[model samples]
Target: MNSFGQAVDASNLDKDVKSTTLHSVGDAAPDFSCRTTDSREFKLSAQMGRVVLLYFFSSSNPACFAQMKYLENEVFQKLRRRDDFQMIALGRGHAREELVQIGGEHRLTFPLAADPKQEIYTRYFSKYVPRIVVLRWDGSIAYQASGADYEGVLRLQEVLARELAAARTR
Candidate 1:
């Protein structure tokens, strides 16, 4: 739980309480049947066996942009090459071309997608920008954040660590 007394249970908590509960955590991640820059259908549930970073943000928000920039340096690059993990950049505020450009500019090899009307964000928040909800290979919620939650940043690594450990086991 955060210092704000948010439940962070990993599943459904009252929107008023703002607590995501254990059920929410283990529940099937809300699927994204959205289009990507590659014209590919990016469905969250389809990639069930892969570790995922369900990254949400708005290009117009500076904090979101800053968080992405920081992540590009701190988290993205380090996690980029892992075969078990993948990132899907989702939001409504940017055009598909613009999002593709951002990915190209950042040398991102991951899927940069558009949810122009925010079908995905509403599944997660009533309000908030740069909300990142991470997921495990089984398609369960691992962690989430809004704005610049650097303290919560380590949540990003949960997948990679699990994947690496699995790879070593194999």
Candidate 2:
């Protein structure tokens, strides 16, 4: 069951969808900077003292859309007000203009970035859409998930909560 007490059907997820990620839990997250759809600069290194969530998706993938919706509705809504939390949804291989249009169409409230050349996305993973990476306050990777499945999304929420609590105590 998910946080909302709904049953998550994982059987519908594509079995072949897997993450070929280069980073692992406890590894230092790669730092990069980019301009968000809102014209704000986002630098991973600058978010050192905060828990950062990086969401990579493709605008052309329907499964990615589903995951994006979950992040926006379930994750973003609950954590947007936290000063120690930052979320960036990046369009893998998409240009800034495309991300801006997508943000407007989806009414996304969080920062939307564009990785037109896959520069940022390639640093984390070589394949897979709807990938999520959670960085600890100290710039290490705390959690990562691949595919647009509820199980992954739920796990991300759990990891984020735990990481945030741990950060608060530091």
Candidate 3:
């Protein structure tokens, strides 16, 4: 341990920093493959050339509903329009049946994935639930946060609207 009392454990840092000697805004997102709520598998490697938003969450979190509902309204609407981009909702916990029900109840249109073993979460490089990472067409991470921020959605909407439109043509 350091004199400042912060743990001296390098292993305690984010995976991105651990794997690579450097961190930058334009780094490619780590690849991941995991099952959706309905047991369909999603592979990040296969999603190259496509914009993907990786959202990690857990059921029973009080604030999760807000994030879910917000996506259903803001981000989902954008991502589902023509598949220029994809939003992969991954649940670190909660029953698959419950995920389906909650998703349907809210009219969430994007694909809802599940990770019983947290394999996907670990692969993506985060230490908490309710985290979000937005990736661009080339698999580079465009934005990320530890939790859902209404303002973040608004900003992303603005950026994605233009990008997705351009993507549709080319």
Candidate 4:
């Protein structure tokens, strides 16, 4: 049971939360499926042949909003045309309606997914929102960022470019 005033069930929490181990580079990313804001399903395994930049954020977070805007203006604008790469932003443990509203407000161009149960979030790490994870073509973790900092976001872009370039050779 967590001490945040909300009743918590031990069984409901992911094992990693108890172990306090968050996935890092070289680890295999756990596959997950979630409902997009457009009501379509998104499966991580389906994007195996392409490098993916997955952003986990919260709709209500200001830092998350800034990060999304930065991504839209800087990263997604440059990479949307490429076939070997894909970007997805998931609202960390949020509902579909909330996700759609957030996307609309931010004018996000990339696909947005809802994670009401935080299943995917917990799989990567039992941490707060505004996190980014880069996954290689074979589903291995390549990079991860826990905060919405310019340097981290920029570094993610660099790492992603390198990974995408390498994936094309295979």
Candidate 5:
């Protein structure tokens, strides 16, 4: 069983979608810096010692919205206060103002970043909305999941808990 109490075979996630990410688990996570909706700079390389969750989404995709809702309600709410965890939701091809508006509409507490040119998104996948990538404390990719579904979210929750626990012990 996974963190959400369902039997989750992480190995069985949609195969085709799973292969979409350019970087795989254990690979070094690509580094990038972007201005967030809140006007703060988010640099992935600076977050080395903490577990990081990168969520790439499109503001116009309904499936992405569903996934974002689950993340805000289920994941972010519970982990927001943790000093060792960071979550950033990147809006692919979205302007800063648009991201700000979306964040307000969704009541998202996590940082919403703007990747208006696909500069960041293309480094991970050529196409896909609601792509999730979890990076370990050492800056390596720990997990990757795609799609807007409960199972993917649950798997992410499980991986996050495991990674956070592992980071604590190191």
Candidate 6:
């Protein structure tokens, strides 16, 4: 720790230790594999050529529902039509059946993935719900945030639009 009370640089720490830290803007997103609520396999490595947006939330939370609604109305509607982009809503602390039910209830257009074990959630973020991680085509993070309030979602919408445009041009 320094006199300013900040921990010293950890760049030289073990890779595993570094990975546990919150992912920053330019960090390469950790690759993960999981089954979508639709029963299809999703491998992060396979998405290397496309932009990816990973939305982490609890299926039972109303705030998460609001976040999804904003994403559905403003973000997904536009991004879903693109060929070079994919958005997967990952449900933490929710069963596969619950995730499917929520998706059906919301008429969500994007795929919903289950993280009942919280493996994916713990790997990316330490706390907070409705977190969003936007990845570029090469797998580096373009944008990331822990909360999805109205303004935050709006900003995310803009970021997604800009990232999608950049991905298409690549």
Q: Scored by CA lDDT, what does every candidate get?
A: 0.67, 0.84, 0.68, 0.79, 0.85, 0.79
Off by over 4 Å in 2: 1-19
Sort all candidates by TM-score, best to worst: 5, 2, 4, 6, 3, 1
lDDT (tens digit, per residue) of candidate 3 on 1-170: 32112344645434533453222447888787867766777888887767777777876564667887887777777557655678888887665777798788878877887676777677665455576777777778776655455666687676677556656666
Candidate 2 lDDT trough over 10 residues, lowest sum: 10-19
Model 1 per-residue lDDT tens digits across residues 39-146: 988777787766777777776665666667776777767878877767777865667878888777766656778877777767766655667777777777766666
Q: Which one is best on TM-score?
A: 5
Over 86-162, each residue of candidate 6 has an lDDT whose tens digit, in order, gives 88999988789998889999888788888888998888876557678899989999988654456677778788778
TM-score of each: 0.73, 0.88, 0.74, 0.85, 0.88, 0.83
lDDT of candidate 4 over 1-170, digit per residue (tens) = 23212245645533423344377689988999877777778899999988999998886667778878989988899899998888899877788888778888879989998888888888877765677889998989998766566678779878988999889998
Error of 5 at 50 (Å): 0.6
Rank candidates, lDDT, best first.
5, 2, 4, 6, 3, 1
Give stretches of model 5 more than 4 Å off.
1-19
Off by over 4 Å in 1: 1-23, 104-108, 158-170
Per-residue error for 104 in candidate 2, Å, reads: 1.2
Clashing pairs in 5: none
Candidate 4 residue runs with Cα over 4 Å from true position: 1-21
User: Model 4, poorest ten-residue lDDT window?
Assistant: 1-10
Estimate the TM-score for candidate 6. 0.83
lDDT of 2 by residue, 69-90 (tens): 7789999999999989999998
Which is superior by TM-score, 1 or 3? 3
Query: Which residue pairs in candidate 1 have backbone atoms (N, alpha carbon, C) closer than 3 angstroms, thus clashing?
Result: 9-21, 9-22, 10-21, 10-25, 11-20, 11-21, 11-24
Clashes of 5: 0
